[model samples]
Target: MSLQQVEQIISILNKQSKPYEWVIQEFHKVDELKDFDLDLETFELLGLAFYLNQDNCLSLKTRTTKIKEETFCIVDIESTGGIKHGQILEIGAVKIKNSKELDRFNTLIKVDQIPENITELTGISFDMVENAPNLKQVLRDFKLFLRDSIFVAHNVRFDYGFISKALHECGLGILLNRYICTIEFAQCCIQSPKYKLDVLKELLGIESIHHRALSDALAAAEIFKYCLSKLPYHVQTTEELIKFVKTSRTQRKIAI
Candidate 1:
């Protein structure tokens, strides 16, 4: 699926208000999404989540949920090198609800080879993943663990884009969960010389192994919580937080 299409879908969802009105049953018709397919395939390929409400109308889950009640899955991955040509070597994630971590998903992905440079960076050698599960299995499991929770990462786009690409390559659909990028979100909350995961890790005094997937994911989770605590009173819904990091989307880019 085209990534641009997913972005377009997100724009539509972001603009939706009082989600109940969009429910087909309530309106006796599909409005904004009349031409949009809300099927499983569409949901997976677009990285969005919606469900049939008690009224039997489809409603966007993230839009209605309060930020304090939302669940977030902070994710990080280690790959061979590049998004286009590389393979994911490891997947690590932490599930957060109400600012606390409740569970984690961590696994190594089996690959044919590991480049030396990648090994030097992440310290994950081919042998490290030699006995691990295959790419498709790991991704399938990750998707299950992810559920409809928000997909969060340090540089949201890279991890999100890479995983979406990897899933499609494995014949799985793209990720449709709403996501938050710690890098951009941090910029709105803290003053830092740089917002790289490692840079913020040091500035924020977050302790973790620098390059490993789980460690990095934990570090990003810390950053995610920090940013949340700094959010203005006006921003309370999950959709508001999702739109907060992108300056153009929110009323004003918050800088503390």
Candidate 2:
């Protein structure tokens, strides 16, 4: 219902993952918990809108799905500035299934202002967004394109956090999908000196435009697949793959 509620779902799962009973009780809302029927209806509504699942797991697809079978939405966004006040100028995503790009979504969002420096960096002026769809409509469409896939982005926190906040602002609820940062994921698998999408794209010889959303998303999709090939042999399930990148900080420190 709220960002905090979605966050509560994620926090509980990361700590004590399982079915509804264990998680619902922890919410201090056991009175609302039921083994079936109405409870499932509630969760199904949450799941349909926010990616929460009937199993009470926020990352329903990531829990047991194999890495090779999972569909990853590699995304990139050009925003006006900071997440707190900025608007998304553009958003682009590449849906990757079995290490191949299966679908794509790209759109500019209508806005009235964009800082000069932001314009310089992303080449996205207010004029460019003038005729585009509003953020709410774009978010609703993006949600449909996103489906239940794992979200991937270079600096995932910014994109994921920003989009989640924007979605909430648009009354779309927060994203409950599992996500992975390519920078973190790359650290676990590659020896790149820099992890910025443009930097890694150059290092990896991925040819694409630098700042635009769709081009960058395509580049990130390449990076995601490239890094996937380098993952430890044991990283089979989507859970293990997500876990692998998350534990990268400590694991990479050992090599340093």
Candidate 3:
């Protein structure tokens, strides 16, 4: 589809003032998108616009001039765990530029089988996700969801590690995006002894619903925002913040 057609869809989306999902549904009805195969840039742009409409995130505006226009995708995964590697049952993420939510995506991933204990803990039964999109499709969709954005998560390393491994196993390239761990930033910025999401949420008074993908994404986004507010002024740009996070462990090692 032509950019003009996409632009028109975006325009309609911008004017809708509806919830994000409704807008997505409406946009899908557009003639161009009916059979649309979005090129990478178009998909990213569309995704950004999708999140700009969120009420919770509208208050945090992007200062594009102050930092690189590079976006950040805050991610959370739900899985069957404590193995060498485990099955990812769900994926959730929200993109942010400046401080505003740009776009979001969440998907349930169908695995060949789910363990019994795994089903109990997560309430994600094998039958529930049986007809859901497989890992390959979900990852492809997520990679598109995250295009041009730095990957971020609470602990961050685990989410990125799991995703990197999953993508590689699917014959897709590992994500080369820069990343920051909110947990690391929390250690640097907050005095809490523990940084688990629920613990930190209680300490910060950021109420969150548990286990669901979008809820977890929202909680991670909140934690990230709190950390951003606490960072030193010198670490203003995305590049500078990345450097600070990269060197944070070195500083801790020296102190130890």
- Scored by TM-score, the top model is 1
Judging by TM-score, tell me the better candidate of 1 and 2: 1
Q: How close is candidate 2 to the true structure, as a TM-score?
A: 0.82
lDDT of 1 at 130: 76
Q: lDDT tens digits, residues 1-256, model 3?
A: 2334444544444344455445455445654354444333443433332235336322111223244365778999988773245878899999887768888898889887778887776677877897999999999888877865777898887787788668756765455455688888677667676888888888888886777777888898888877776667776656567656667633432211
* Ranking 1 against 3 by lDDT, winner: 1
- Show where candidate 3 strays beyond 4 Å: 1-65, 249-256
Question: Could you tell me which 10 consecutive residues in candidate 1 have the lowest summed lDDT?
Answer: 23-32
TM-score of 1: 0.85
Q: What are the lDDT figures for the candidates, one per model?
A: 0.78, 0.75, 0.67
On residues 1-256, what C-alpha lDDT tens digit does candidate 1 reach at each position? 4556556655765675334344323322323233454564455434556766566445577778899899899999998878888888999999999999889999999998998999999888888787999989988888878878889999888898899888777766667688888988887888887889889988888889988889999999999998898898988889888777776323335666
Per lDDT, the best of the predicted structures is: 1
Candidate 3 steric clashes: 2
State the RMSD for candidate 3.
12.3
After aligning candidate 2 to the native by TM-score, how far in Å is the CA of 75 from where it should be? 0.7
Count of backbone clashes, every candidate in sequence: 4, 0, 2
State TM-scores per candidate.
0.85, 0.82, 0.69
